[model samples]
Target chain A: MSALLEVEGLVKHYHVRGGGGLFGAPVVLKAVDGVSFAIPAGRTLGLVGESGCGKSTTARLVLGTLARDDGQVMFDGEPVGSVRDARWRSQRRAMQMVYQDPLSALDRRLTVGKQVMEPALVHGLGAAAERHEKALSIMDAVGLSSRFFDRYPHELSGGQRQRVVLARALILSPKLLVCDEPISALDVSIQAQVINLLVDLQEKFSLTYLFISHDLKVVRQVAHEVAVMYLGRVVERGDPEALFHAPAHPYTQALVGAIPTPRTRGRARAALQGDPPSPINTPPGCSFHPRCPRAEARCRSEAPLLRPLDDGRFAACHFPVLSTPAREAA
Target chain B: MTVPLIELKDLTVDFPVGGNWVRALHGVSLTIRRGEALGLVGESGSGKSVTWLAATKLLPAKARIDGEVLLDGKPIQGLTRDQMAGVRGKRVALIFQDPTSSLNPVHRVGTQIAESVRLHRGFDAAAARAEAKRLLDRVHIPSAARRLDDYPHELSGGTNQRVMIAMALAGEPDLLVADEPTTALDVTIQAQILDLLAEMRRETGMALVLISHDLGIVADITDRVAVMYAGRIVEEAPVDALFDDPRHPYTQGLLAALPDVAGPRRRLTAIPGQVPNPAALPPGCAFAPRCPAAISGCVTAIPSLDAVAADRRTACFRAGHATPWEIAA
Candidate 1:
C-alpha cells in the first residue's frame, strides 16, 4: 500500500535567548533534530511522548505551520517544498489540523456555524446556502446539535466547542488530519465521548491520522501503530499491540511503565532520574543516555540508529529490554 | 480508637447560577484516618475539588456549604474568616495541580515557604528561614539552603513542585489535600512526586485526600478509593476491591474505558455521552444517561449508596454484580 504521508530527515530548531556565560549566547534549541516516519493510507500513527518532547514540533512541520530546516515531506508521492506552491494550496484541502485547545483555535466572536463553514468558504466549496447546510450536516455528524449553530464559542461547553472544531476539520473532508492532543484539554468524562466521535468519524470517512498526544492511554485507544519520540527523535516505532506488549527502547519502557494501571497497586516502578537534558546543548551521541538506566560506555560515544528488530519493531537503543517468557507473562 | 483526623459528613456545596442554586455536591460523607491516603477518583465536574475546598472552608462567599466538616472532632463549618484562615494551613494544607501557578513569581521560593511557617506557626525571621530550608530539604530539593533565594520561574517544573510540597508541609498539617498534584509534572517526575508524598505521609502520619482523574496513580498510592460521577459518589471501596471487582456501572465503565497496556488490541468501550451539567442534572440518577447497565427504574429512583459486598458500597440499581461489558461471555 502506498503511504499517504512521508516525512524524512526532518529538522527544526528554535532560536532561544540567554544561558551561555556572563553574557548569554543565542542558543539554538534543536526541537526536531532528525525525525522520520510514514503514515499509510487510512491508518493512524500515534506519536507518544512526555511534554517538551518535540512531538508538537514534528506535527507543525507536517502541517506546514512550522518550516523545517532541512527535510522532505512527501504527500501522495509529491514533494512539498513550501506552502506557497499553488499545488500545495489544493493539497491543503486534503489536510487539516485539530488543535489541543479548541477555545484558542476558534474565534469566540464568530458563531459555531460560521466557524464550521469558514473552512468550506475558504476552500471555495459552494454557495452560502450550500455551505450553511454543509456545516449543519457536519455538526450533526459529530453529534453537535443544530441549536449550537447560532451560539458563540463561549456559550458552549468544552465538549461542544471541541465538536465544533471537529466539524470544521471534517467540512474539508480531508484525507489526513493532524490531531495534536485534541482531547487533552477536555475533562475525562467528555474525553471518552470526543474520542468515540473521532473513531466513528474515522471509520465513516476512511481518514488517516497523525495523532500526537502525551497520554499513552488515550493514544493506545485511537492509534493502530505507535511511534515513541524522545528529544526530537523517533526512538521507537512499531505496531501498537507489539509496542505496548513488549516495548523495545528504555524510554518507551519507562513511558509504558509510568502509565497508572488499573489491575495492580504500588508495583515498584523503575523511575528515571532528573529532567531531560537541555536540547540546546545536548550531550554527544544518545540524547537520552544521560537519563537512561542502562547507559553504558558505548551509549555515551556511539549513537545507535533506529534498527529493526527480528519482530519488525524498530528501536534506537544500546540495550533494549530483553523479551523473554517471563517478561511476556505479564 | 479515636475519631478520624479529618471527617466530612453529609457535605453539600452549592453555587449560585443565574439566581438559583446549582448543587455541585450532594450530601457526600467521608473520613480519613491519620496517615491514610484516600483517593477521590472522578471525571471533570465530578465535584472532587469542590468537595475538598468546601471541607477546608476554602470556598468563596458565593458558594453555600452545609453539613459537618470536622478536623480533630471540632466542627469547622461556622468558623469566622480569621479562624478559618488560622485553620487552613495549620490543620489542613492544600497542594494544587499546577505548581508554577501556585508559587508567587516575584517572591523567592524560600520567602514563600518561610511566610507560611511565620503566619501559621508564628516563627521569627531567622527561625522561619531556617525552618523553610529544612522543609525544602524534607521534600528532596537538593541544596535547600542555597535554592531558597531562587525565584519560582528560576526553578525547573519538578523543583517548583517540590517548593509547593515544601510549602504544604511547612505548617505540619494533620491532613493534606493534594488535588491533581502530579498532573502538571512529567511521568517520571510524577512518579517521583507521588513517592515524595508517600514518604511524607509515612513520616508525618498525616491523612491525605488525593483528588485526581488518573485511576492508575490513585490505585498506586491510595488505600481506599471513591468513584464520583457527576456530583455523587457512585462507588466507594478499598482500592484493590474497586479495581478487581467494580460494583457501580459507571465505575465498571471507567475501568473498562481505560486502554489497558497489557490487553489485546481491541476497541476501547467508552461510556456514552458527556458528564451532565452541574446546574442541570437529571432528576433521578445523574449518570443514567451514560450508564450502560441503566434500567427503567434507574431513571426515576436515585440509588443511595448501599453495601453490595463486604466493606464495599455502590450507588447503582444493579449492584453486587458486573456490568454487561465486564461479564464474561
Candidate 2:
C-alpha cells in the first residue's frame, strides 16, 4: 500500500523570552521536536495528545502552512517543497485542512455557498457559474440543503457550519484531509451527527484523513492507526484497538485511562499524576518521566527511543508494559 | 430524615426576545442532600446552568423567574439582596468553565482568594491571606506561597482553576456548584482536578453539583444524574440505574451517541434534527421532533415528569411500560 502522505523527523523550534521582560533570558520552545507518521491511501491516522503536545503544530507542518526548521514531508510519492515554491502552491489543492472552530473558520459576511466556492475560486478552477454548480453539488454531498446556499454562517447551527467547512475542504477533492479537533466545538448530539457524516463522507469520497483530536473515544472510532504523543514526541504508535486495549507506553496507558468513560467510575486514583510540564522547559530524559507511574532511576537521565514491539507497534519506553506474552521478545 | 441541603421547586425562567419571551428553564424541580454528588448532564441551552443560576437568583433582573428556592427547607426566594448575597457565595459557591476569564486578571491569585475569604469569613487581611494560602494548598497548587503573588495570566489554566476552587472553598459553602469546571483544562489536568474535587468532597463532606455536557465525567463522578434537554429534565435516576437502564428516549439517544473508547465499534445512533428554537417550541414535548420512540400523543400533549419507579423519574410519555407506571402513580 502506498502512503498518500508521509512525514519524518519533523522539527519546528521557536525562540521565546523567558518569564520576565525583554532582557530576562532567551528560551527555546520546541513546539514539534521530532514527529513521524504515514497515512495510507483512504485510511485515517489518529493523532492523540494533550494541548501544547504539538499535535496542532504537526498538522500545520504536514500541510506546509508553517515552515519547518528541519524535516521531510512527502505527499503522493513527491517531497513537498517550501511554502514559497511554485510546486507547493500547485500541490495545496490536493491537501485540505478542517479546523477546530467552524465559526471562526468561515467568513460571517459571505453566504455559505460563496464560502464553499471560495477555495475553487481562489484556485481559478472554473467559471463563476461552474463554481456555483460545483458548490451546490458539494453542499448536497455534505448533507446541507439548498435553502442554506444563501444563508450566512451565523444563520446555521454548529453542525451545519461544520458541514460547510467540510464541503469547502472537499470541493477540491483532496486526497488527504487534515481535521484538527473538528467536532470538539459541537454539542454531544450534534457531535454524533457530524461523526456519522464524516464516516459516510469518508466512504463516499474515498478520503484519507489525518484526524487529530484529544478525544480518545472519537479517535478510536475513526482511526485505524493511532499515535500517542507527549511533549512533542510520539510515545506509541499502533492499531487503535490493540493500543487502546492495553497500552505499552506508560504515558499511553495513563492517557487511555484518564478519559472519563460513561459506563462506570474508573479506578479511584487518577492514572497519571500532575500536569504535563511546560514545553519550553520540558523535563530531562523521558519527557513523561515526571508524571510516569513506572519511572525508575535510569528513566531520570536517559530518554527512551521509539522502537517496534513484537506486534508491530512502536513505543518509546524503557519498561513498556509486559501484559502480552509477545511483548517480552521486544 | 433531615431535610435536604437545598431544594428547587417548580423553577421557571424566561428571557424576553425580539418581541416574545423565550423560556430557558421549564418548571425544574430537584433536590440535593447533604454531601451528595449530583451530576447535571445536558447539551447547549439545556437549562442545566440556568437551573442553578435562577435558583441562586443570579440571572439578570430583566429575566422573570418563578420558583421556590429552599435552603434547609426554608424558602430563600423572598430574601433581600443582602440576604441573598449570603446564599450565593457564602452558602453556595459557583465555579464556571473558563477559569482564566472567570477570574479577575489584574488581581493576583492569592489576593482574589483572600478577598473571597474576607468577604465570606469576615477575616482580617492577614488572616484571610493566610487562609487563602492554606486553601490553595488544599486544592494542591504547588509552591502555594510563590503562586500567591502571580497574576491569573501567569499561572497555567489548571493552576488558575485550583485557585478558583480555593476561592470557592473560602466560603466553605455546604453546596459547591461547579459549572463545567474542568472543561477548559487538558485531559491529564482534568483528571487531577476531578481527583481533587472528589478528595475535597470526601474530606469536607460538602455537597457538589457538577454541571457539564460530558456524559462520561458525570457518569463517573456523580451519585445521581439528571439528563436535561430543551430546558426540561427528561430523566433523573440513580447514577447506576440511569446508565444501566435509561427510560427517556433522549437519554437513550445520548448514550447511544457516545462512541465507545473500548469494546466493539458500532455505528453512532445520533438523534435526527437540531434542538428546536426555545422561543418557538412545539406545543407538545420539546423532544418529540427528534425522538425515535415518539408516539402520536407526543405531538398534541406535553409529557410531565412522572415517577417511573421509586428512584427514577422520566418526562417521556413512552418511558418503558409507561401505561403501567401511569396507573401505579
Best by lDDT: 2
- The B-chain TM-score of model 1 reads 0.96
TM-score for each candidate, following the candidate numbering: 0.95, 0.96
- lDDT (tens digit, per residue) of candidate 1 on A158-270: 88899999899999989999999999898765787788788899999999999999888788888988999888889999988778767888888878777677754667777
DockQ of each: 0.59, 0.52
Docking class for candidate 1? medium
Task: Score candidate 1 by TM-score against the native.
Answer: 0.95
lDDT of 1 by residue, B208-305 (tens): 89999989899989999999888788899999999988888888888767765766655666666778888888878998887767779888989998
Candidate 2 C-alpha lDDT tens digits along B112-134:
99999999999999999999999
What tens digits encode model 2's per-residue C-alpha lDDT throughout A1-330? 879899999999999998777976999998999999899999999999999999999999998988999989999998886666878877888999999999999999999999999999999999999999999999999999999999999989899999999999999988889999999999998998899898889999999999999998899888989999898999999998788887899888778777887753544544576778889999889988988878998888999999999989999999998584211111
Off by over 4 Å in 1: A20-23, A145-151, A324-330, B326-329
**lDDT, candidate 1, at A224:** 83
Q: What share of the true interface contacts does each candidate keep?
A: 0.57, 0.66
